[model samples]
Target: MSEPGLPPFESIIAGLTARPLARCVVVAPHSVEAIAAVAQVVAEGAVLDLTGDRARIKNLLAEAEVDVSAVRIHDSGDSDTAVDRAVDLIRTGDAEFVVKGSIPTADLLGGLLRQRLPGRSACASHIYVMQLEQFGGRTVLLTDAGVNIEPDLATKAAIVENALQLYSVLSSARPRLAVLSAIEKVSTRIPATLDAAELRLMAERGKLGAVDVDGPMPLDAALFPESAVNKNLAGEVAGQADILLAPDLNSGNLLAKALVGHHAPAMGVVLGAGVPVALPSRGDTVATRRHSFYLASHLTRSAATSPNGCDRE
Candidate 1:
């Protein structure tokens, strides 16, 4: 049976209505597409333009009926510089978050890591995109597909941690994790299965925290209780995962792409930084971009307010 009480994306936003406004400093505010999206977010009380462009910048300020002089226009040469400035603003509490605009993902993250923004959580930090899978009234989070290439066991653990941190903000309890692989049993040759075993042991030993971690499960068994029962899988997380951790980037990318290709409603973001970063692709629909911005804002507002940065919750 499908889970009950699974809320839609809009309902999640509505639930957060009582939270304070989310303030963000965008890296590039001039790209017509980006600016338009930012404008909509600003209108919704979520972002502030921080790009150094004067002409388009002035127009946005004017459109908002805010004084141009009140905003600072830094003559940063590249998106990296703008990202650096934005991260600084976030760290100093001048802004609550940062957004990637007209910049390569590398540049944004390069500046962020080099600048030691938000107290530098860990060098092994990773990114995760959450897909809300509605089944039997339940929402399942499938992640690490939009970010992270091929990751080793340690990196996989970190990626799972990063995703779970976001789940904590979105839900009331800890999440159940399914480490995906081609089969349900470990073998000597398949590295994913071996890693899955280790990850499950890590969870059992409390190294992976309160999250329930199970792995080496086929995708079918990961999402459908009937499949789990058919396979005689004996665990709560086997077919009822709150978070689906992909084995590698190729799998993750393909899975997310397949969902979108099939017309599944989804939103994505880069997590594990000091704050949530909206890194939507240029090819995404305006609605997807806007929804990503909303997800990022939700993550930023609920992110822990400590300098240590890494979140175990």
Candidate 2:
């Protein structure tokens, strides 16, 4: 029998409606996309605490006739200070999570990393949660695609740990991790394969948290049951991985786009910071923004279920 993990993305979105959340979002509203994304968040019933260009945001919302009853505006002046203002909200207990509005991802994340937030990890990694039909509607994760560029072995381990923490919150079963590589053989010719080998050993030694790790595997083996069977691979995570740990950013980014190219059924968030962070792309649709915020808010709803005790009210 398959292990119990997160429900399908459809069910997750439905659950948000079934169990409404009470959360506050601190956003840097500068671009048109930011306002559009924040509209979806407010539609989800979250209180929006706008942190940039207070007057401009108010005027835009008024012109668009967006319901501002639940919106709160704060004057931060510019994107740089807006990030600071958002951090201040997190520090003062005014907001629970940070949403990437119009702020550049590098600036926002860099600013956040400088803060000494509670429960912060050495490395902050991004996890993309997707429901793959090839995996029987199972919710799977692809990690560090949007954050780390060229993570070393130690950084890859931190990324895996972050993914594991998030997995624990969303599932009842122990996470089955597949460390992705070019091939299944551990050869020094390929550095990713070596990292995969180390990660597997670390998991066996209880160094990578409560999860089953298998790696040095190709993508075909990671997501295809037939490939696992044909190759005679009998490990626990051969074709039933809950999280697919990418070797580096280039491969991770390409893999995610390939898997989710035709549709938009993925939810993304950053872990390892003091709180869950949603950094949805500016080009993403409003629905994507809604689901991303919902994903972050869902993590915040229960402290017992949050990764590394990372969620804060």
Off by over 4 Å in 1: 1-7, 17-20, 55-75, 123-138, 301-313
Worst 10 residues of 2 by lDDT: 304-313
What TM-score should be assigned to candidate 1? Answer: 0.83
Give the lowest summed-lDDT range of ten residues in model 1. 304-313
lDDT value, candidate 2, whole model: 0.76
Best by TM-score: 2
Predictions in order: lDDT: 0.66, 0.76
| TM-score for each of the candidates | 0.83, 0.90
lDDT by residue (tens digit), candidate 2, 1-313: 4654566778777875565544555567766766777776667566778788888888877766668998888888877788888888888888887788777777777777667577677577889988876556677989978888888877788788778777766777778899998888889999999999999999999998889999889888877778877767678898787899998888887888777776658868887777788878655777787777777766664332222322111
Whole-model lDDT, model 1: 0.66
- Cα deviation at 182, candidate 2, in Å, is 1.6
